[model samples]
Target: MPATPAPAEFPEDLTLGIRELDDQHKTLFAVLDRILAVSRDPYRQLDDDGTNTVLDIMTDLKDAAMQHFDQEETLMDQRDYPGLDDQQEAHERFLDDLVRIEADLMNGTAVPPVRLHADLADQLAAHVREMDRELAQFLNKSEK
Candidate 1:
């Protein structure tokens, strides 16, 4: 079997000023980085223990992501944001994907690390560029 691939590293340009959301994003990226590091290290073979560690981290990330989405959705509702439904749906999709990934991992059918990393990076970048960017703009406009 082929070895797992490395995780994608986060770019600095992906920042949004929403504190809770930003922190969750950072944590998710860090966990991804950790997974990549473990997958890529030739000298360090990841045994079952290490694999379990990765799984745990992924679980934590998933939980945190759900919380972040909830908080963001609440904010949108409170502000009566015009794009609320679409944004909430996007968040729901993200959570669903994470749950699917977790299930795959548990069932020993996990996707290759590289593919997972790429998918996540693409989604996150798109999300930040489209949804989060709009949200930030709205917040800024409201503040002004």
Candidate 2:
């Protein structure tokens, strides 16, 4: 198993200037980091204990993401943001991805931990910088 370096700290550019959402994003990144830390070399196949740890964290992440998405969708709805539907669709896709990953892990067909972490991190950062940032801007503008 090749040793892949853990992911860097969460990128500052991902922050959307909304305290609640920013904090939730941080929590998600932190959870991703935890997945990397479960083993010394994430490229290695996980042992039973490591697989269990990853599974547990994935569950926690799914729950957290669900709550965060609900809060975000509620805010968007209240503010009448035009992109609410797009955001909802993206959120659904993300949740679906999580379920797929969890299923793969449980079925013993998962990719290495590092790959999983990288894929999830990239997807989340992209979502935040695009959809979430747009929502934040709309929300902030409506506030003033």
Candidate 3:
């Protein structure tokens, strides 16, 4: 019989050149993968404790992700970063996706495990490219 593969991992290229931001992004990626795994494990029906664990992970993802955004926003404010608004909008969209996932899990829905993971990974990659990298460049430029 074939074996199931391991869960998803945070891609190296997603690093934003900001320690806290990068760490949180990595954590979010892992948490998302974990959530998806738990939700899809046919052998494990999420019991109350399992449900609470998933909920806790979701809360952590939301809190840590928002905290990273706050850190980036604070830095942007300090540098008067031009791309701050766009970053905030993207952050809001990411948070909305998390809320939807959390709601689905709470309601015992299918949760679209694979697609949700893929969507979050894609969003993170795109956000890093579109927003975080720009901010990183601005910060580096201003430092020189």
Q: Which candidate is the best by TM-score?
A: 2
User: lDDT tens string, model 3, 20-124?
Assistant: 777777876777677666554523446666666777877988897888888878888889998888888888988998888788778776334455556767887
Q: Per-candidate TM vs. native?
A: 0.78, 0.94, 0.79
Report the Cα lDDT for candidate 3: 0.73
In terms of lDDT, model 1 sits at 0.73
Best by lDDT: 2
- Candidate 2 local distance difference test against the native: 0.90
What TM-score does candidate 3 get on C-alpha atoms? 0.79
lDDT of each: 0.73, 0.90, 0.73
After superposition on all C-alphas, the RMSD of every candidate to the true structure, in Å, is 3.7, 1.3, 3.0
Candidate 3 lDDT score at position 64? 77
Give a tens-digit lDDT track for model 2, residues 1-144: 566675659898998999999999998888787888888788887888888999999999998899989998998998999999999999999999999998988888888888889899999999999989998898899999
Would you list the rank order by TM-score, best first?
Answer: 2, 3, 1
| Winner of 1 and 2 under TM-score | 2
Error of 2 at 107 (Å): 1.1
